[model samples]
Target: MQKSLHITPDKCTGCLQCEMACSYENYQVFNTSLSRIKVFDFHHTGKKVPYTCTQCDEAWCLHACPVEAITMDKTNGVKVVSEDTCVGCKVCTIACPFGTVNYVQETGKVQKCDLCGGDPACATACPTGAITFIDSNWTGLDKMKQWAEKLSNQAHA
Candidate 1:
């Protein structure tokens, strides 16, 4: 049973603990800039939303890499970028529709959330229960789509 990160933006409080944990886990530092997960602050609305790679099934970033640096881990369905093979061309960054794939200036290689090898640090560090690792079937994306469809129907009524 594959698990996925289920994110609920409404529960986030902008504390940025997720970012700190992520950076620490991946880079051995506590720098938000180095973290793969980002908390977006909506200034006008005073809301915070934590965002990261969803690890899409299509994985446009993986497909766009010229050197095939990114490969899907079949066991867990995570798209992992091989830094040794990556050329830092930034094509994967461009191909990523969600802007999750990023170029790390220090390493000159691209980076994205690899689910922390299926134990996501960001999810574990989320204090408000905003992020949870759960079964892929219950990721909440399907519910969001249904809600959007309902709104669309109401709009057309």
Candidate 2:
């Protein structure tokens, strides 16, 4: 049963707690820039969407790595980058269409979300339940359930 991070952008408050938690868990620091998860703020619409690696089934980053630095974690279906193997070529960064994979200047390597070893800190740190760690097979279950409830209410009315 693989799990995944489900993000509800509408529930996010742009608090940046997820970034702080992710950085602290991975790098032992509270730097948002160091965090793998990034919150994109749309000033015009006043919307903030927390974005990270989706761990694609056919990951382009994993395929683009010349050194084979990126590999899939079978346990959680996450694409993990090995810093030791990474040559900082930035090929994976370009291959990823989502632009989730980023090059870290300090380490001279690419970094992205690895689901924090199957227990995502960003999801846990989210105060408003905007980020949730859930079963990958049913990521849309919540939305479906919500719509079902609404329909049920309409039927009752």
Candidate 3:
């Protein structure tokens, strides 16, 4: 059962607790800029959506690495970067479509979510339960159920 983080944008409160937790866990600081997970705020609509690496099964970052610095962790299904092996090529950063993988100037290395080794701090820190560690296979189930309910209501009407 592979695990993944499910984010409900509608439930997000824009509190940035996930950002703080991610930065603190990786950098030991509260700097949101250093956080791998980012919350995009839409001022006009007052909506916020936390975004991060989806840890794709066929990860472009892993394939793009020149030195084989990025490897998949079998346990949690995450592509983790090896700092010692990384040469700061930034190729992996460019390959990622979601723009989750980023280069850090302080370390001259790329960084992204590693599921915190199975105990994701971001999901734990999300006050509104916007982020949840869940079975990867069922990620779309919630959305499907919601749409099914709407269709059922329309059928009865």
By TM-score, the best candidate is 3
Model 1, 82-126: lDDT tens per residue?
Answer: 999999999999999999999999999999999999899999999
| lDDT digits (tens) for residues 105-139 of candidate 3 | 98999998999988888999999999999988884
Q: Which stretches of candidate 1 lie over 4 Å from their true place?
A: 139-157
lDDT (Cα, tens digit) per residue for candidate 2, span 91-126: 999999999999999999999999998889999999
Once fitted onto the true fold, the runs of candidate 2 whose alpha carbons sit more than 4 angstroms away are 139-142, 148-157
Q: Of 1 and 3, which scores higher on TM-score?
A: 3
lDDT of each: 0.94, 0.95, 0.93
Sliding window of 10 residues with minimal summed lDDT for model 1: 134-143
Cα RMSD to native, each candidate?
Answer: 4.2, 1.9, 1.5
What is the alpha-carbon lDDT of model 1 when measured against the actual structure?
A: 0.94
Q: What is the overall TM-score of model 3 with all chains considered together?
A: 0.93
How many clashing residue pairs, candidate 3?
Answer: 0
